[model samples]
Target: MKHEIRFIINGESRSLTVLSQQTLLEVLREDLGLTSPKHGCSTGECGACSVLLNGEVVNSCMVLAAEVDGADILTVEGLATDDELHPLQKSFIDHHGVQCGYCASGMLISAKALLNRTSRPHEEEIREALVGNLCRCGAYADIIKSIQVASRARR
Candidate 1:
């Protein structure tokens, strides 16, 4: 069954017809052309499909598109403006947190969620927040450093 849904994405209002069985990741990547949310593990074990749903990080692959009607969703693409990048993006670049690009989107989203809530999260809290996200390149150290850098820079 197809259902019509309205939601806010990247500060923009979007209305789309989504199938009941379709996941948010599917609707985002296929229908909306938002490729920042990757599909790594459909079972939600991998956080490659992470996105901010109402300012909280969630696995898009695990969320049903029809269920999120009228909800606010934010992909990695929504993080930056036309002229400047988000602090996390700059921090990621500065700290060499991104590698292979497969996990970068999800990792970035998770970090964004953390920063939004905690502003300056402890290292352990950072680790706990990102535990679901996996970096194939083993860039955990750099990613952690990137979060720390973003927090420090923001303050």
Candidate 2:
């Protein structure tokens, strides 16, 4: 059955008709054309489809589109404003944290969720927050450095 859902995405309100079985990741990428959330391991173990639902990090692949009705969603593409990138994005670039770029979006979103709640997180906390995200290129050192750099920038 198709159900109509209203949700806020990237600070914009939107209404979508989605199938009951469709995951939020599918709706966001295929239906809504928001492709920043990569389709990695669809099983939700990879965290490639991470997004913010009501300001909390979630695995979109594990969430149903119907479950997010009236919720606020934030994807990687929404991180920037105008032509400027988010501080985390800039820090990632400056720190050379992105390797293959496949995990970059999820990593950034996860980091944003952490930084949103805690301005200064310890290295262990940062690592714990990113436990679900998998970077095949082994750029964790740089990724952590990027988060630390962004934290300093925000101070």
Candidate 3:
């Protein structure tokens, strides 16, 4: 069964027909061609397919496309403006937070969600926000540092 869903993706209004069983990850990558959210783990353990659903970080693989009707979604592609990259994105590159790059999008989304809630989140808060995301390259140190730097930069 296919259902039509209308949602805001990367600040753009989108309406598309999606299979009832299709995950948001599938709809984003396969249907919408938004490939930043990688399909790392279909079971949602790896956190490689994270996106902000109405400003909250969620595992895209675990969210059904049909469930996002009228919701606002934010992918990594939406983080940047025309003039410059989002502070977290710049900090990620400068701090070497992205080692293998597989987890970069998800990490960025999670960090963005954290920074959205707290302008100056503590180190422990950053860790808690990213607890669900897994960096296979073991880049947690750099990732944390990047978030810290971005947090300070935002203020």
lDDT of 3 by residue, 8-91 (tens): 999999999999899999999999999999999788798999999998899999999999999999999899999899999999
- The lDDT per prediction is 0.93, 0.95, 0.94
- What's every prediction's RMSD, in angstroms? 0.7, 0.7, 0.8
Better of 1 and 3 by lDDT: 3
Error of 3 at 147 (Å): 0.5
Q: Model 1 Cα displacement at 71 (Å)?
A: 0.1
Our tally of clashes for model 3 stands at: 0
Considering only N, C-alpha and C atoms within 3 Å, which residue pairs clash in candidate 3? none
Q: Where does candidate 3 have its weakest 10-residue lDDT segment?
A: 39-48
Q: Cα deviation of 16 in candidate 3 (Å)?
A: 0.6
- Which residue runs does candidate 3 get wrong by more than 4 Å? none
How close to the true structure is residue 61 of candidate 2, measured as C-alpha lDDT?
93
Q: Give each model's clash number.
A: 0, 0, 0
Residue 87's C-alpha lDDT in candidate 2? 95
lDDT tens per residue, model 1, 102-125: 999999999998888898899999
Of candidate 1, the 10-residue stretch with the lowest lDDT total is: 37-46
lDDT of 2 by residue, 46-76 (tens): 8889999999999999999999999999998
Model 3 lDDT vs. the true structure?
0.94
Q: Which stretches of candidate 1 lie over 4 Å from their true place?
A: none
Q: Name the candidate, 1 or 2, with the larger lDDT value.
A: 2
